[model samples]
Target: MSPDLPCIVFVRSFLHKPDNIDHTEHHVRQETPKQIDGHTHRRKHSSDSEKTLTVEDWATSRENPHNWPLAKRVITSLVVYIYTFVVYSGSSMFITAVPLVMQELHLSEQRAMLGLSIYVLGYGVGPLLWGPLSEIPRIGRSVVYFGTFVAFILVTIGAADVSNYSAFIFLRFMQGLFGSPCLANGGASMHDLYPESQFPYTLALWVAAAYCGPALGPLLTNSLVNNISWKWTMWLLACMSGPVCILLFLLPETYAPTIRYRSNAFNTSHNQNNNNTSSQDDNPLAKLKFYLVKPVQITLQDPAILFANIYTSFIYGTYYTFFDAFPIGYPPVYNVSTTTLSLFYLSVLVGCLLAVAAYFTYLSLPNYLRKHHDNTSPKSTPTHTPPTKHERHLIPAIPATFLVPISLFLYGWTLRPSIHWIVSIIGVTMYASAVFIILQCLSMYIPSIYPEYAASLFAANDFCRSTLAAGAVHFGIPLYKNLGMARGSSVLGGVSGLGVLGLLGIYYFGERLRAKSRFVERLVE
Candidate 1:
């Protein structure tokens, strides 16, 4: 072992060690370049395999909101309704502020009213954007809820701080733009929470909440306007918004496609490890493209959806017109203060409460009993199927449809100063009740008709209702002025009569229309 010999031994040991160069080179020498490349590829493949992960539903997974506990679904639904209540309340709360707004801003009555009308128009158009984003499996309901909710609050605050009428109008419009997701996506969220069987009842409560919010809004803001500045009314909205924003964050994602996407179970691509790159659009523009095109396509192609949009739009227009009509009739005839006038809006709320009660007793209980009976009945076949997959609950929408015309006529005739005010209020209540019933039926039925695209279907309905309501809000006041409450409301009543015919047309022919469309399918089993 001379020193040179020792150096040689150290070099051989370093180079030829089994864990280092020796075994690697031996394999390198044993194979051609292609074979060596193949061997290297196999090693790389084995390394990649360990990094790959699979997503599957476990037994009793909570990924599906339908499987969430009753408490979670109920709380979440209540939060969503509260969010809607705030949005709609914001829409009408400023009605009391219109006179103050005109006075302070030195604007005309028409321009002052545009604040509210434009806000509603924004709501109509907002769904054109938010509706599609929400349906994206990547974006989902929770994100829309949180994002829109925060935007609503900020816009409401901006509305309070704006000094100019134009800025005020812009902010109000932006407020509606941001606030509309709750209205547009709410029914779809309810659909996520419950199975098809439970949607009608839940949707009825939801629509009731939404209507009642607008009714209650004038009541709250009347005090704010009378006691505080009109700016405070906007501030009141901002204050109310804070808590809803918090709750929206707490809500679990209820959009099914989104949940499936997150769980990786929904994407059918073989390489989900690519982070759903193949299944979902990485570009915002691509997502927007689908969002914009699909709902319009659905609305244009589907007769049932188009009819529902038109039917609800008429009802919505009439409802907004009442905001002006009630104020006009009572202030001049009864000489009521704005605050007292706001109380008259309660007629609609009373009607809503009664309709809700009637629904629970007449529709909900019977449907539940029928369901239980069918499920337990010996007549149920060996397959244990329930009797019918179609929503027999919609049977009520038909008879209730006629009430709109009757109530409208009654509301018109009873509004004269010669008549007692309570009599007129009763007429309004009847109209409200009928409208509630028709709307609940439509909301529930439309979603059932297009379960796969419930959000888009709902967005279409929202767009129709809000756009018409925006036009009505501006034109409705003049209409009452031109025709007087009696003739104006009578004209509306006659229009409502047309709605009854439309409803009848839908009731008899709706199924045939739905069956022809490929975009939608029957909801139930």
Candidate 2:
């Protein structure tokens, strides 16, 4: 078995034995051979006559997620989408309540801001632990999803009732930590159910849910905070998550390795062999090291990946900073109440919806059909050929890179009493749309480039982005306070403009960078 693959083989002894048999019945362990350069090499077993199951067999089996009924897969996908939304909403749902929390706890603005920043930081850290555990066939994704969510509910309930500043902050971090699995693993779960051709569409919907969750958070809690109390925000999160937890119970295990393992265990029990049991490395400590250490190593060693992560972190930081920036930019200029300001977040949802529509209309569907026709067509040559398959994934990001700076500049300059607030909102919508495109492109493109490290790359991506966003939450208010809206936003816009260069460089030169990467070299070998 390849260590690169997230699978482990085990040997087990059956309890029951035939009365005439003096020897113990041992299960035959099958190791799916690794595929390199489009060729598969199978390992030789002790008994050539013994029936063996291969990875190809598992791929076509009814137990495989891709082989499941359409309705089952759709329902499962919906559950994951909603679960992600509920968890992501927790990060920003408390923004409107910061003032109330400050007043109630007798805290300063910076101290109160920890409620949001600390939670964001927790998301950055939780994935390092959860990402590895979910990859274990014995552990699986469903357990991670259900278990942490229950913990999230408990932490949220505690956060709602806590009065001490320290306890509230601690509970807030716990909320993010416990709620992060969906954010870290949601894409992988979707990948498990769909082929590459169809995955981008599902991922688009998933990304929309993720983006819209925080975007809609303030809107959902605005009325509650204005009418009742800030604590209701936490209570609302708990209430919304409770039913979703029940729905998760109906979600079958989607991780292919876990399903394969279970099926193998059943088969081994029924048909036992006297052949010596073969197994992969089963050391827990070694497994843990691979999961935790590999992602950081890959990110640092691969320049392309590192730059991509940095760009993503900047975009995410700007997005979270908006949570703080909106209050500063909107209320004073528009003379709007908190409730009215919350409505502006809808512009983000509008941007996300627009991006999704455009992705399907222009990119995902057309690319999928093109690939399908190429596969089925009689002629060996196709009319259209992209520069590179992976690079083609980044086409939308080209325009999006320029849009980031343009939108940021427009947003920064337009926040004046003389200017209509709708104009600034158009900037917000543009920024949101650009962010959605850039992130979605990177999310798909990065994994495609490094298929072996997809899970770890995602964990690293989440950690880097969330860590920056956490800092942004802290510094965002102060940036506006000291530099004022126009200057502070220009600073951010200027930083984003650098991403335009970085993205363009990556788009044109990414293949060369990959060819130089030590990690990529290892995969080639």
Candidate 3:
């Protein structure tokens, strides 16, 4: 087959049903060799040579993951969250050892921080590779999870055993690269496994893990490092990886096209006429090119994608910026022990819990008001609708937009030695709460807006977030060191203040922005 034919065929299939397309007959295609016995491969050939197959339905289809039993869906979601938690912990676990690694390896400050800086750089770059591969019909999401989990486990163990600084840096980078698939595509998996109505609550939990893991990582590492050794941090993380690998294998594939292609009742004339496999099977480079280009295209083309990315990037960058800002106030003026400082991080966790509480509380208001207003009309049970474009707007997070800067101001101003340490911690907790609210809101809105390309949309968001945060960390530490904590944090707060405009822009004009974009328009349809 010609190189362009694969692209053309894919576009045609995507835009129309297989039966409607003149050139292709729809029948079950055994795209994956390792089928799940009766669950995956159920095909019946027609009396005539012609074949017919249809896409899975949203409600009735057994092949639809949304149609799975509630208990099974919950178990799958738990496994995905565990996978997310383990992988994200690897990113920040080394943070506590930054000082120790420098001392033990006889390294300079810049060189020592490279272990994290390079690892974060890998986080941004790795997904550009993983996001595309995860979408391949032949490979799918679970295969990517399985492969990356193994690589992550081995590299993490290598991190514990590294004899030299260069080896440490390389291994850390590899660990970040291998561990990034969940961060990039975990939301897409949630979209695959659950219907839209259930996504908000599900995302709240998953995103909490994503944020909480990085906050929790330093605490785990701090305890281990202070008591035993810094190297134990990597070993413990490797041990955690063992269970995640088991969980990864247990969850079956949920990517839709992959499922449809593997389903016993589905097939295509493209498979029979050309006798050629997926482009990923034939031209691996071309497949790679398609995957790599899609994220870039989405990032550039969609205004909503671009601004949502920028907003989330700044929020994430602020989260890392606080990593530096927190130490300056706590370790010096408060003179807290490493263990005590680690526990203070829990204030951020408390803030996240409060954010979750606020989310549910705010969510409940709409339901209550809607029911109260409609009570007089009839006693008929209400039916559910998929969230509309306006309903998915970031309006609910509007309260958070103002709160982040205000909390930042309070956190910065109250960090003086004259002030009580708990006062400053409280201020920072407010910052954490506001940030969590904003980040969680974007997490839900972006994926819901572009459900078809949710993984790539998330990949773009992660790319912006990780890259910006990694780049800013070098300057962040210096800012806190050169300027005093109060002044330094005020500067950080000022930057966060700018993000308010981004939130307001999307809130007011997001629908118009989405309407203007071809990619989002197509995806919405």
**What is candidate 1's lDDT per residue for 294-404, written digit by digit as tens?**
557778887767777888899888888887888778888878888789999988999999988887676545556766755663443443333233334355667777888
Please state the error at residue 356 of candidate 1 in Å: 1.7
Where does candidate 2 have its weakest 10-residue lDDT segment?
10-19
Candidate closest to the true structure, highest lDDT: 2
Q: Which ten residues in a row have the lowest lDDT in candidate 3?
A: 13-22
Total backbone collisions, model 1: 0
The residue ranges of model 1 lying beyond 4 angstroms of the native Cα positions read 1-59, 260-287, 298-302, 365-393, 515-525
Residue-level lDDT tens digits of model 3 in 316-412: 7877777667665688888888778777888888888888888877665665565454443323234322234443446567788788778777877
Q: State TM-scores per candidate.
A: 0.80, 0.85, 0.82
Q: Can you rank all candidates by TM-score, best first?
A: 2, 3, 1
lDDT of each: 0.70, 0.75, 0.68
Best by TM-score: 2
TM-score of 1: 0.80
Residue 402 in candidate 3 has what lDDT?
82
Clashing pairs in 3: 27-266, 27-267, 28-266, 28-267, 29-266, 42-264
| RMSD in order of candidates | 16.6, 8.2, 8.7
